[model samples]
Target: MAKLIFVNLPVADIAASTAFYEQIGATKNAMFSDATTSCMVFSDTIHFMLLSHERFRTFTSKAIVDARGMTEVLTCLSEDSRDEIDARIATAIAAGGREDTDAAQDYGFMYGRRLEDLDGHSIDLMWMDVEAAAKAMQPPAN
Candidate 1:
């Protein structure tokens, strides 16, 4: 069986968060979704579980911090190209997300940009040429 990852997030509004993820290319998996929880699939193996604050509290005893006021978690995804990253960022912005253009990371062979969802969860979209990046990381000859 293929390995899979499920990223759980506490959202203020399940519907809004579901819509936001959909606008950014994730599809809601109805099988694992309900009124207070949603399963947003980014790929065959990558999924985001959006849970309401009340629903999320049942799973953990720790206090849920405000993502807007401070950094909680930074999620990064790979893109097919730099153009795709830009397109996704624009789409996210149009869907009520905010882009952190000042956080753009560019290293010639690799580039990335970040955006925050309605709840301020940061998602970074990146593109990289694997071969070029490996070459860039090689030690310089003496």
Candidate 2:
């Protein structure tokens, strides 16, 4: 089987968190889901495992950080285009997530935006056009 990535997150509300993810383009993978956990599939190889706080404790002894107060990680996903990234940000906000206060990043060849989910998990969305990036590196006419 191909290598797969499962991003595990501690969530206060499984239902709400699952809904939030679905709103932003994910499907529930029932094979790995239960009352206290949800396996949200972003694509063939990318998945998110949202576990209730109590359930998440089983995996670690360390206290779970309150994401709202601290940022332990910044999870990013690539989009096909800038428009797709923007649409997802809008969808996320409408579903109760908030946009990060950081200013938008535009490197001419790449663009990105960030947001915080209901559980305060930082999610960064970005798009990069490889051809454009290569072209941009060439010296301009003198």
Q: Quick one: best TM-score, which candidate?
A: 1
Pairs clashing within candidate 2: none
Q: What is the model-wide C-alpha lDDT for candidate 2?
A: 0.95
Candidate 2 regions exceeding 4 Å error are 135-142
Model 2 lDDT per residue over 1-142, tens place? 9999999999999999999999999999999999999999999999999999999999999999999999989899999999999999999999999999998899979999998999999999999999998899899989
lDDT of 2 at 13: 98
Poorest stretch of ten by lDDT in candidate 1: 98-107
lDDT of 1: 0.94
- Cα RMSD, each candidate: 1.0, 2.0
User: How accurate locally, in lDDT, is each candidate?
Assistant: 0.94, 0.95
lDDT of 1 by residue, 86-133 (tens): 999999999999997466899999999999999988888989999999
